[model samples]
Target: MTQLIFINLPVADLDRSIAFYEAVGATKNPMFSDETAACMVVSDVIHVMLLTHDKWRSFTDRAIPDAQVSAQMLLCLSREDKAAVDATVAQAAGAGGLPDPNSPQDYGFMYGRSYADPDGHIWEVMWMDPTAVAAGPEAFAAHDLTPA
Candidate 1:
């Protein structure tokens, strides 16, 4: 069986998070959804579990850090191409997500952008050229790293 990923995120507003995710192309899985939690399907093997703060606390005793104040792990998703990466980040921004405070990345063979959800969870959308990846790190050294 193929491995699947379920990323659990604490949301300040479950409904809003659902809407935000839907706007960025995820579909809701009602079978695993409730008033306190919503299952957002990113792809066949990837799912995002949006849980209300109360519901989240029930599962873990660790304090939920204020995302705005603390750095948590960044979640990244691969896209088909650079345009796809841009489109997802644009959709996220249009849906009230905050664009990354830092500049976008463009490494000739790779491109990426990031945005913050309503609850401040950081999501990065990226695209990497398969040929470039296959070529390996030598390709990176051959190209200019400076942003255009």
Candidate 2:
């Protein structure tokens, strides 16, 4: 069976978070959404469940860390190409997210950028040359592969 990932995040404003995610290309899955939580579909196998603080408390007793001030983990997603990575970050900025909390990384074969949502959840978007990946490093030394 195929596995799907549901990233559960505690959000301060359900509506704002929904709008922010939507602006970055995720579609709201109303089937799993209510006032307390919303399921944002990022892809066929990727979903983000945004839960209100009160709703989050029901699942865990630990205090919800202030995402703006501290980070527990950094979430990342892949894109089709370099341009797609930039576009996602731009959309996020337009939606009130902080663009590039981290510096852009360009390894020629791989490119990555980041953005933080209004609630301060950092997400990295990356792209890698498929040909280079498939061919591997040895192929590059053999002059058989080059990143575009």
**Top-lDDT candidate index:** 2
Compared with the true structure, what per-residue lDDT tens digits does model 1 show for residues 37-136? Answer: 9999999999999999999999999999887666688899999998998898889999999987447998768888899998888998889999988989
Q: Distance from true position, residue 124, model 1, in Å?
A: 0.8
Scored by TM-score, the top model is 1
Task: State model 2's lDDT.
Answer: 0.93
Q: For candidate 2, lDDT tens digit of each residue in 1-148?
A: 7899999999999999999999999999999999999999999999999999999999999999999999999999999999999999999999999999988888777789999999999999999889878988764574422323
58 in model 2: Cα distance from truth in Å?
A: 0.9
How does each model score on lDDT? 0.91, 0.93
Q: List the residue pairs that clash in candidate 2.
A: none
How big is the positional error of residue 110 in model 1, measured in Å on the Cα after superposition? 0.9
